[model samples]
Structure formats: C-alpha cells, structure tokens
Target: GDDMAILAALGLQSYRFSIEWARIEPEDGVFSQAALDHYQRCIDACLSRGLAPVLTYHHFTLPLWLARQGGMTSPEFPDRFARFCEHATRHLRGFDIACTINELNLPLFIREPLMARMTSEKALARIAAAEAVLHGSINSFFLYSPREVILNQGLAAHAKGRDAIKSVRSEIQVGVTFAVQDEQAEPGAEALRDQRREDFYGVCLDAVKGDDFIGVQTYSRVVSKRDGSSGPEEGHPRTVMGYEDRPQALAATCRFVWERTATPIIVTENGWAGDDDRRRAAFVPEALSELHDAIAEGVDVRGYFYWSLLDNYEWAAGYGPKFGLIGVDRATQQRRIKPSAVLLGDIARANALGADNRSAAAPQVMGDGAPVGL
Candidate 1:
C-alpha cells in the first residue's frame, strides 16, 4: 500500500513487480486463494492511483517443495507453471503486460553447480550461510545443473504460460525478459564475440521472436577479446556492481536485439547500483538520451521502467547496494526520496526529456554503420 502511494507520488503511471511462484503454490497442485487475493488487492491499489500494473509471473525463487522435485528440470515443470498461470490470471483484472519469466538467460552465465564444484569448502560455507540469510525458510540449495534443463524448459513454460493467460483472459500481452549485455568484439575477435552472444542470449531471443514484446534488461557493455577474456574496458567509470558506466550501451543493445528478433522492445530493468544519487540522477537522463536516439532511428520501444523504485533486498548482494530512487532506513522503515527520484518524476510528467538533457551530438557511426554515442 505504501509502495504504491510512493510510486504515485513519483508521478509514475506504470508499475512493474514480480509475483513469487513459491507464495502462490506451496505444494505441487495446491493453489492459495489467499495469495491470489493479496495480489488482487495490490493490483487494485495500483489502479486506484491510476497506475498500470505490469506483472511478472515468475522471478528467481521456486517453492522448496518444487525445488526438491527437480524444479525446472522436472518433466512436469512447464505444465505445472502453466496451471499456476491459469489460476493466477483468473484473479487479475487490469494487468495489461505480463512476463512469463524473469531473466531466463541468467542460468547460462552463473552456473551454480560449477561454482560450487570449483570454490573451496570455506567459500562454499560462506555462500551457504548467505543463502540461508537471504532466502530465510526456503532451502535453495541445488546439487545439480539445471542450466541446460531450464533453457529448454523455460521456453516451454513461457509458451504454456502465455497460452494459459490468453486462455483465461485473451487481452493480456505476454512475453519473457532476458538479462542482456551490450557485447562488443575486440579488434580481430568479432567471431568470438558473436559466438559468445549467441551462446548466452541467442536461444532466448529466438524463442521470443513471435511474442508480443521482448524485455531488454541491460546494465553494461562487455568486450570479448581474442584471448577469451571479456569485461568492461580498462579505467572506465564503474557502477557499484563493477559495471562500466556506459549509458550508450543501451542504444547499441536495443539495436542489436531489434535487428535479430524484430520484436517490440521494452526496457524492463535499467539502473545503477551505487550510493551516489547525483551519479544516478546524471545516469538516468544520459541513458534516456541514448534510448531516445534508438527510438528516433525507428526501434519500436514501448516504455522504460526504471530498475527499481526503492532500495529492496538484492539476491546474493543482499541490501548492501543502493539502486533506488528513494532511500530506505532499515531500522526505522522510513523512506527518503532522493533528488534523482524528483528528476525522473519530472521526466515522466513531461513525457519527454528536457532540452538540456538531450545528447550533446549525434551518435558516432562505426565502421559497420552502427551509431554509438550518448
């Protein structure tokens, strides 16, 4: 209730939040009406404030019961997810946009089994402790690799979930979001970069080609070298996540995805992880300027929802990183709106960037005819 009020106060007309699968269904076939009712109240609250609700059906966490049964690797996973979607969508009245899954490509990059096998016992113990604190009662320890299993199962689940939603209420626009990085090739390593991009994100993009839209969740650019190293260029201004503060990365990423899928795009998540609100304030307009350039060049971008509205708990990093427009006092539960929140709110109200916030010049055209700049 307070969160919706804060969003309305920020002049935000749309809100994007996730619904945890574990909360909706604790057991295989058991559906919780109480959970559905709770989400309905949340939707109603958003509508009351003239805010359009964008709901993501699944985030990262899975019910402990389901996880024990092999989770995404289980043959029954996709169908079970579809059944849940059908039940949940029946209670949702005004949600226009829905995402079937959040960051389906994440598993390919962060292989938990491989990490656990490689890291020392001490480090693994620390990680286990952290997971315990982060997930509370949920036992999130997985001994096997669901990486390849999920890539295939996730697509099936997305398709089934989309069908399930449409079966119940045909008007909801459904798609899946991917964690995209603007990847560039070092001189003479173009093929390596292409292969890496395909390995990481190509399958997901190909799967969503026929969906209503594709959510581009980009934060930084990665350069692939001939020697197989990849990361942000040396000495660039870095975010708290150690990502390069390259606002122009968004434009290039949008273009790359649009060219391949030809699907309409919506920036699902884009924000910096830092304590400096001034840097965040500056980053927003600059990144928006690059997004504007992409739109000007004819990319069908539907909307931009900032990564977050408040400083909430991040998965592994916990609550240490501040990526919110409004700061939270954990002890007192107080909300303090930062200057960046006001700046973003004003931009939202205006529906366009102010003249001063525009990019300094036209993007520089690369050798391959791609325009790159902020």
Candidate 2:
C-alpha cells in the first residue's frame, strides 16, 4: 500500500501499529489464523521497507467477547489478556519493541460532559440498551469503565501481558505508554499542578519501573491555575484539539517521566491535530530539538514517532484531525506529501538537523510560560 511507502519516503526508521484483538479473535476462544498471517505480512512489509516494526499489544479497543463478560472487571481479565499475548507472540513474529497497552491512564471523565452535549438521543439510548443487554451492569467499554477498576485491572494486565510476551520471546523489549502533559503550575498553583500530574501519570509511571522502557505521548502544555481551572495560555496559537502550540511540552514531559521512573524513554506519540501544515512542519523540529535537549541532559531517550503517517480516523473525533505528514485525497485515496514530511525526511536522511531547523527551534519564552530554553 502507498501508506507504507509514504512513511518510508519520509525516511522514518520504524513504524508502530497495534493488532486488533477483535479481528484476531472475534468470538470467544476463537483464533483467526488468517488474521495472524495478515499481520505477519504487514510486519514483513515494514521490514522489507527498511522500517523496524514496533508493536503495541492493545490500544483501548477491547474485544467485545471480553467486554460482554464484564469488560475489565471480570476476574479473568488478566488471564484473558495473557492468553492473547501468548498467542500473538507465538504467531506474530518480527517486532523486538512493543507496548503492552497504549495510554492506559487517559482521563476520560473530563470529556463525558462534552460528549453528553454532543451525543444524540439515539446514541444515549444505545448506551441504555447496552446496559440492559449486560443485565443492568457496566456494559460500557473499558475506556468508559470505572477508573479504579481500570487502574487495578490495568496493572494486572500489564504484568501478566509482559510476562506472557517475555515467556514466549525473552528478547522482545516491552513497556506501557501513558498520556502525559506538560503540567505547569501557575503562581500559587504548584500543589494543584503536582496533584494533577499525579492523577494523570503517577500510577502508570510507577508500575513500569522495571520494564525496558516507558513510552511518553505528550502533545501540549497545560497550566494549572489557583482558581482550579487549566488550559492553554491566552496568547498562544492553539491546535484544532484546543491545545496550545507549545512544542516545549515534549521536553518537559520527557524530563518529568524520566525523573520519576528513571526508565529508558521512547516517544510513542507526539503531534497536534490541526489544519495548519506550516505549524506542523515548524512544530516537528522544535519538539525534536526539545527532546534532543533532554537527551543531552542525561535522559535515556531512545526514539520518537509522530502520532500518525496518514490523516486517519481519530477515535471520538472521527477523521477531522489532520495530524498526518501525508494528506489523503478523500475521494481518490491518493497521497499528498506535505512539506513537513519532506523536512522530516531530509532530517532523517542526514541524521542531523539543518541550520534553518536549528534556528526555528530556538527557545522563545516557552518553559512554564516563562523565559527559559526549550
């Protein structure tokens, strides 16, 4: 497909993708050999393209067979997850780096209010219907499940899943990725900011201490004010997702995650969703420059991958977010390589930053919204 070719054209060394559990095991205890073979071919494709295949075991999309049996709340949750891992490891070959799960600590509660307003009556009714179908219990997916249950079940799943992968292929480097933000404390808001950071990243960061690496997915900088409200700074440009255009956030999160866990880091996801390709081109270099600073300061930062290679469907937001380096012609499915892709490709090919990128990535009062080097 042109998708893999587009990424290779961007001179990227690796491509990270998650195998769909539902596609592999649509029914309970049912394994699809065809699906496994398909994924093996995908791995081979990446390898053939000279791109390393980085695999993620899970990415929020839980198999309905498991969800119907009480989702992550079921006592068999961890064991079931381990079973899938064992089969995947044994059948799917060719990825040395993998993530047990992606963004296990997402703050879904904050979006419920907005979703309620945006949701149609039919959608709300479907929720009621699903609950009734589950016998008046939690029928919602694990993403919408109770936070405590997610935390507990999540920890267990990672432990068992990691062991399952290692038991089958001891050489595979395994870890979990977390959605982290650059948590900034406004004047008199230090304690509140610390608490916010703890609520979002503390548990997951602490759990992956012994793993080979921890993946950090940071996009924007968030400020915690004394008034208990947090958001982007007033004057900065914002992404379509309403996040501030602060590329320095990547560096801040890298430092935050490394200082806490001391584990090796890989930036699994970091990019904004917006229509401004120019901003994205500028954003990429600045963010990577910030990340390079962290590496120079003794952080064991290994690699980084942009959020996506194509403008694909963004969960909950659909296909609106243009976070891709290659734009897709909707009707024709033709690929349009944006300037950002060329810029990144040149950087990748040279293994060095150009003078223009270096000048553009210079610090500009970005640190904590005050004057400091990014």
Candidate 3:
C-alpha cells in the first residue's frame, strides 16, 4: 500500500518515519550518499503529498560495525551517533519534527522472558548466536538487549543526537519517545506502581524536560499490584498481544507524561493489535476521545499519530500481531484496506471524532514504494 498518499488522502496533517542509521552508516567513518539521498527523497515524498514529515533519527537499530564493537556500551557510541545525525540531517533539509531515539524507556526487550518470548536457556543460546554473528554481544535493539548500560548510552546518544539534528535543522522540534502505560494501581499498589513507573520512565522523562516535546507510546494499561504489574483485568477485553483493550489508556498516559515532563506531548503510537478490524475501528475513536479530553484539559498534545498504517513486522513478536489500518498478504505484496482504514480516514478528514464531528470517507490507495509509514 502507498503510505504517504494514504495519509494525504486521509487528510492527516503529518507522517512520522525513521531514518535507518544502519543503512546510512553501514561502517564506521563510511557513510552512504545513496542512503542520505533515499531518506531525503522520503522527506520530499511526504511534502510532495502535502503531509508534514516527522522524522525519527534512531528506531532501535544500529550499524553492524558499531554493534560488533560492544554496541551501545562502546565508548564511541554517543559521538558516532551524533556524527551520523549531523551528517544525515544535512541531507534532510525540510522536515520539521525529529525524534532522537524511539522508546528510550521501558526496556521493552530487556532480556525478559515475556518480551523475548524465549525460555532462559534458549535465550542464552540465542544470545550466544548473536555474539557469533556480530562478533560482540549484540546491542542493536534485540528483543533481549536492553540493559542499564545500553539505556544509559541511549541517554547520552539522545542528547548528542538531538544537538546534532538541531545544529542542522534548528527549526525542527527535537524530542524522544518512550513506551508508557496507564499504570493503574490496584489495592495497596500505589507505591509499587510508582516504583515500576520510575523504573520504566522516570530517568528518561527527567532527561526530556527541555526537549521540544515527548512522544508517549501507549497501547494498554498496567494494573500494578503490590508485588508487580498484574495480568490484564479478568473481565476486560484483550488484544492478540495479550493486553487489555483499554483505549482510554492513552488519555491516562498523556496526562501523566505531561505532568512528569512538562514538555509538549505527541502520541507517537497507540493502537490495538489484532485481526479484528472492528476492534481497531472502535479503538481509534475511543482513544481519540480520550486524547481529545486530555487536550481539552490542556495536556498540550501536538499530534496523535496512530501506531501504524499497514500491518507489518512487530520486532521480536514477528508478524503475528496486527496493528494496522491495512492488511497485507505477505505472499502477494497485495494490500487489503481494512474497515478501520476508512473509519480512521473519516475521522481524520473530519478532524474530529465522537458525537461532535463524525464523518465517513473511503480510503484513497497510496503507493508502496516508501519503506515504512504511519
């Protein structure tokens, strides 16, 4: 499916995409002019279609040479990242928003079994295999590679990277996005919830205070118990990702993150992951309503970019979990525009949802040449 044209057709105001660090800088000190030109074209493509381009510099991947040299733990990581950012931004002349790194908090792939989806022994074996392939303990956004050192390096990298991008495109709004949740507290769980919250987001939020904005990516809520985050509420609907279908979590998260950082908010991602197009169709309005209320209350949300435009790979989770308005048949490269696509497009065209400004419109098919779109 054509993402840029789809966004324009939907009448969405902006598009967010990542510039591949690995592709632009395949080797240390060796940058690709072709890679720079490719992303420059991508930026232009969005503008050519009347969509504002919101670019993310790093989205959980890195060049191989850097990974082989201890990855994020390498003493050279931050500077190398900044160097790449400055050089890349020079080619990217017109984009206005830049996220320095995506999801710098939560440690979503923190070697934890739930996220890694690997038993401990198999995890170790795969880690071994990673070492074999990269020649160093790989740190290129693996499902099991988020660690204190890695996140700490990311903090430094974000600072330097933000500066580098701003140095070239100072007019651009620079920021970082992190995974967030509603973080509801169960009985006697307030302390535990706050503790978990700090563990996941506190440090990163502290660092983001002065940035132009903070991107909050929330899919569901976490009902934290005294001991730990509880399983999804027993009676609530759940998504294929095994989380509660609480679209209102976006509101809770936006309020909390804005209170914490005082930076402007942009919903970097929020969507249900499943094959049920109705769930997505219903989810968008509920989430947007929540977001609308948050905005009404002055959370200062600048944008609400849905998690995705097409169903595609979901990191370690593979392609099983779907969170797209359009579905693709992998074998055919053919795209199926889901009902949710029309639903969201209608809301986008109306520029509002819920009872006040509901409208319906069919989706206009976009081109498929773009690597990723949202």
Candidates in order, TM-scores: namely 0.89, 0.90, 0.90
Kindly list the per-residue Cα lDDT of model 3 for residues 61-88, writing each as its tens digit: 7788888886776878899999998998
Name the regions of candidate 1 deviating beyond 4 angstroms.
112-118, 123-143, 356-374
**Candidate 2 residue pairs in clash (backbone atoms < 3 Å):** none
Give one digit per residue, the lDDT tens place, for model 1 in 1-374: 78777777767677788877888897878878888888888889888987778888888878776766667777888998999899899877878889898887787766754476648888677767755654542222233455567678888999999999999988888988888899998899899899878988888898889799998888899988878888888887898888999888888888989999999987888888799999989988888888888888878777777777888688777998888888889999998988988887777766667866443332221000000111
- Look at candidate 3 and tell me the lDDT of residue 77: 87
Model 1 reaches what TM-score against the true structure? 0.89
Model 2 CA lDDT for position 73: 73
The window of 10 residues in a row where model 2 has the poorest summed lDDT is 365-374
